[model samples]
Target: MVDSLAKMVGSLQKDVDKSSRYAFQSDYALFIDQLFYASSASHITYTSLLATKLGIDLSLNRLVCLLYIKDREGMPLADSRLLYALIRTIRTRMTNKNQDIVGLLGTSRIVYCPYAETDFFSREKLENQLQALAATLANTYPVIVSVSVGLYAQHVLEYGQSLRSIPAVVQQNTSNKSGSIIFAEDHLVDYLLQIIPKSVLDHFLGYAVHYLQENPVVYETLQALVCNDMDIYSTATQLQVHRNTVIFRINQIKEVLSLNPLHQDSDRFKVILIYTYARTHLNKEI
Candidate 1:
C-alpha cells in the first residue's frame, strides 16, 4: 500500500511539472507586443524599464522572423505544425535564455523574437537565411507555409514599421510567387506602390515602360541607381562601368525625364515610384 501511494504521488507530480513546463506566458508575450507599438518617449522609456525588470536585455540586437503561414492560393493558414516549428526554431536560435518572448497574436500571426549580439546581423545574410529556412520548412513539414524571412529590426522599437508594412508586402508580392514568402524589404517597391493610388502608378508606368523599351540599359542603370540608394560609385560597381558613365546616364535620364532624381528628394520619390512600378508591374523586362 505504501509503495502504490508513493508511485501515485510521483505520477501526479510529473503531470503537474509537464503542464507548467508547456504553459504559455501570455502576459510576457503581450507586454513585448505592446512595446513594439510604443512610440512616445515617456512610453518607450517606461516599456524599456519594464523590459529590464522582466530580465529582457535591452542592449542586445532584436530581430523577428515572421512565419506567416499561408496557402498557395495566398490564403492564411492555421496549423499546429507552424507553432511547433516556430517554438523549436526560437529555442535553437535564442541567444538569451531569459529573453525568449514569442508573440502569439491573431490566428495567422506567430512571431519569434530572437535577441543576438550587437555585431551579429546584416540584411543580406538575414534574407538568405530566411530563404533557406523557408525551403527547409516546406520540405520538412506537411503544411504549406509561405515563408518570407523578414528583415530584422536592430531595436525592438523599430518593430512597428516592419510589422505594419508586412501585410501590404504580402498582398502585392504574393500573386506570382506561391510557396514563397514575399517581404516588404525584398519588394520594397511594392510597399511604396501600395501607398500611391492606382491611378498615379498607371500614369507613371507608361512613361517607365516607354523608357524601358527604348534603351533597356537606361532602365537598368536607373534600377541599379535606385537599388544602390543613388550612390554613383555603387551603381557603377554594380553595372561594372565607370563612375563617369554612371553620371552620364543619370544626366541622360534627367534630361529625358525632365527630373533630377540624384539631387532632389521629391524627384527621387517620383522616379522611384515610376521605376518600381515598371519593373514589378508592367512586365517590360527591363
Candidate 2:
C-alpha cells in the first residue's frame, strides 16, 4: 500500500507542476490526504519524499502547515499539497531564470523570499514586486496571496528562525481589512507575541474570548486597534466610526480584560498575544 501510494504521489507531483502553469488540480488533495493517513509507517516516508522532491526542509512547522493548508484555502492561504509544490516550482523557475531571490518554502504555501537592501528602495516598491509575484501565482491558482516582508538575517537558517512569528503574522495580514501585504517591520509588537508559549498565550487570551462571546464588537475593536498599531484615528478610519467611539470601545476592552494595552508596553504585548491566540483559535480575523 505504501509503495503504491508513493508511486501515485510521485506521479501526482509531476502532474502538479504541469497543472500549476495552467490551472491547479483540486482532486490531488484527497489523494495526498489518503496517502498521508494510510499508515503511520508511510506518513514520514512520504512526507520526506515530498519534501526532498520539492527541495523543502522537513521542519515540524512545515509539517503542521501542510496539515492545515487544506483549510486555509481562499482564506489568504489558498490550499493543497500542490500549493507548496507549485511554490517550489515558482522559486526554482525564478532562480533558474534569475528573476527573483531564491525563497525558502517552509510549508505547502508560505514561501520566505529573502531580498537584499538593493532589491527595492521603499516598502511600496518591495510590495509591488511581491504583488507581481502574487499576480503570477493567482494567474495559475485561483487564490489571493499574502506576503510578510522586511525579514533579514546573515544566514538562511537564522532567517527561518526569525519566521517563528510568521504564522501569527500571516493570519493577521490576511485578515487585515485594508490589504493582504504585511510589512513585518511595521508590526513589531505583534511579532513579540510569538515569544509566549501557546498554552500561556491561549490562557491569557481566554478572558477576551469569554468577553467576545457576549460582546464581539469589543473584540472587533481590539483587533482594529492592535492591527492599526493602537492608533485611534486609524482604527476609527478603518472601522468607519468616530474616534471617540473607538476610544470608548477600547476602554470597554480594557475594563473587561483588565488589560490596558494603550497605557503600558507590557500590557500591549498581552493584548497582542490574546489577539494572536484568538485569531488562530477563533478563526476570526482581528
Candidate 3:
C-alpha cells in the first residue's frame, strides 16, 4: 500500500508540474488547490504506514505534524533523492535511539520539490499542508515531533537566508527560535529592509524610538556619539557642549534604554548598533 501510494503521489506531482506550464493566471488558484489535494492525499498514505507499523488503527483525518531540520550554509536539499536520504537519516536516528516509528506518523517531515521553475503548486499551499500534517501527527504519534518540511522554492530559500543574516541576539530573543527555519511575514521583511541601512536597528530601534519620544535632546547627543569616534571628550567638543552635558545625556540614555554604557558590553554594542542603523537606514535629519 505504501509503495502504491508513493508511486501515485509521484505521478500526481509530475502531472501538477506539467499542468502548471499551460495554466493561465486565472487558473492558478485551481492549480494550487489541486496541489494541496495531492499533498494531503500523499500524507494520508504515510499516515497509514505509521498506523500499520504501530499496530493501531486510528482514524486520523488531517496532517498537522511538522519537523524542521536546521539547514545551515543554505545547502539546497530539494531533490527527492536527497530528501529521501534525509528522511532515512531521521528514521535511523530515531530507531537507533530506540524511539518508536509508529509515534512519528503525523509528526513526519514532507519533502517537496522547490517552487522555483515549477508550475504545478504554490509554496503557501505546501506550507498549509505541513501545518495540517503536523496536527495529524500530534494525534497519531502521541508525542510531539518537530516535522521539518522542505520546499523547493527559491523565494523560501532566499527568505531563509536573509532571516539567518539577522543577528543571533534577535533570533534568541524572538518567538520563532525552536524551529530551524525562520518563517517571516511580508511585513516583517519590509520592516527589516526599512531598517537595513541602519546597522543594529533591530537591536535598538524600539528603545531609541521610545527614549527619543520622551527626551528629544538625547537624539542630538546620540547622533554626536555615533557619528564621532568612541571618544567621549571629542564627541562633547564636536557637539560644542560641555563634557559634563555629554556625560549627563549619555547617562540619561542609559537609564531610559536600560543600558549601562560603563559595565555592559552587550548594551553598549546594542546602542552603537541602533545608532548606526538609524544613521544609515533612516537618514533622519539630526
Candidate 4:
C-alpha cells in the first residue's frame, strides 16, 4: 500500500509541475483528493516523504517544521553562504538537549526546522530562539526571515490544510470589515485595522484594490522594484518611465498618506503585503 501510494504521489507531483496539462486533467483533481485522503490516513508516512523530498532527515518522532522564507520587501535577497551557515546553526541548536531541535532544511536561504513537539510552550520558545538566531544571522547574512510554523502529529494532514488557508484568511480579514480571523496572539483582522490609521489603510487599499485596473506595465514595475530592491532609476528605465515621474508618483503617494517613502520601510512593507495578498487572491480581494 505504501509503495503504491508513493508511486501515485510521485506521479501527482510531476503532474503538478506541468501546469498547462494538469489544468485540463480531470484525473488531477481525483488524484489530489485521493492524496489528501491518504495523507490524513497515514500522516507520518506522508510527512516523512515530504521531508525526504525536501532533503531533510526526519529523526524526531513528534516533529513540526517551521518554514522561514525571506520577506523580499523588507529584507535583502538570500545568499548561498548565508544559507549554509544558517543550516549549520540550526542543526547545532536542534541537537542541543535543551533546545531539542531535531533537523534542519535549507533552500536558497529559506530554513526549515523540524522540532519534537507542538506544545504551545515549546512552540513559543522555539519561535523566540529562531528569532534570536535570525537576528544573529542578519548581522552577517543579507536576508531577513519570515516564519510559518507547521506542526506535525497524527493529525498533521489536517493541520497542514489549515495552515494553507491562513493566507486566505488574512486576506479576508483585511478586506471584510465584519470578518475576523485570528492571525497571531491577540491580533485579529479587526484589531489590525483598528490600530492602523484609517487614512493610511485607505491609501494602501487604494493602490491595492484597483491594482488590476492600473496599467500592468506600471504595476509590474512597482512590484519588481519592491521585491528585488532595485534602484529607482533602474526600475524607471525598465518601466520606461522618466525618473522624475517615478519620484513624482512616489512623492504623491507619501504626501497623500502622510508617510515618508524614503524612511517608512515598515509601513511600505505592510502596503506591499496587502498588495501581495490582493494579487494572489484576486477573487477574495476586498
C-alpha lDDT score of every prediction, in listed order: 0.65, 0.54, 0.44, 0.47
Tens digits of per-residue lDDT for model 3, 1-286: 9997778767755555554433442232332223233334444343334335544223311122235322333332244444444445444433122212212111123422222223434547655544554444334332232333322223212322332333322332333223223233312433354545444554538557656645657877876775674468988888899999998988887777777754677776666665655454555554
Worst 10 residues of 4 by lDDT: 175-184
Which candidate would rank higher by lDDT, 3 or 4? 4
| lDDT (Cα, tens digit) per residue for candidate 4, span 23-85 | 453342333232233443343454445545544443443333433434335443455565656
Estimate TM-scores for all models: 0.54, 0.45, 0.31, 0.36
Stretches > 4 Å off in candidate 4: 1-78, 95-119, 122-124, 148-156, 165-286
lDDT of 1 by residue, 1-286 (tens): 9997567546643443343323454445545545556655644555565576687776566665566655555566676667656556646654465765565555666675556555666666655655665566556654445544344565656666566657656665444342465556666666667667778777766765687678989988988999899999999999999999999998888888887988899999878877877876676566
Instruction: Score candidate 1 by lDDT.
Output: 0.65
Best by TM-score: 1
Model 1 reaches what TM-score against the true structure? 0.54
Among all windows of 10 consecutive residues in model 2, the one with the lowest summed lDDT is: 60-69
Models, CA RMSD each = 11.8, 10.5, 16.1, 15.3
Per-residue C-alpha lDDT of model 2 across residues 35-92, encoded as one tens digit per residue: 2232333443544465445444433221111111222244534444557665665665
lDDT of model 1 at position 61: 64
- After aligning candidate 4 to the native by TM-score, how far in Å is the CA of 224 from where it should be? 35
Q: What is the lDDT of candidate 4?
A: 0.47
lDDT assessment of candidate 3: 0.44
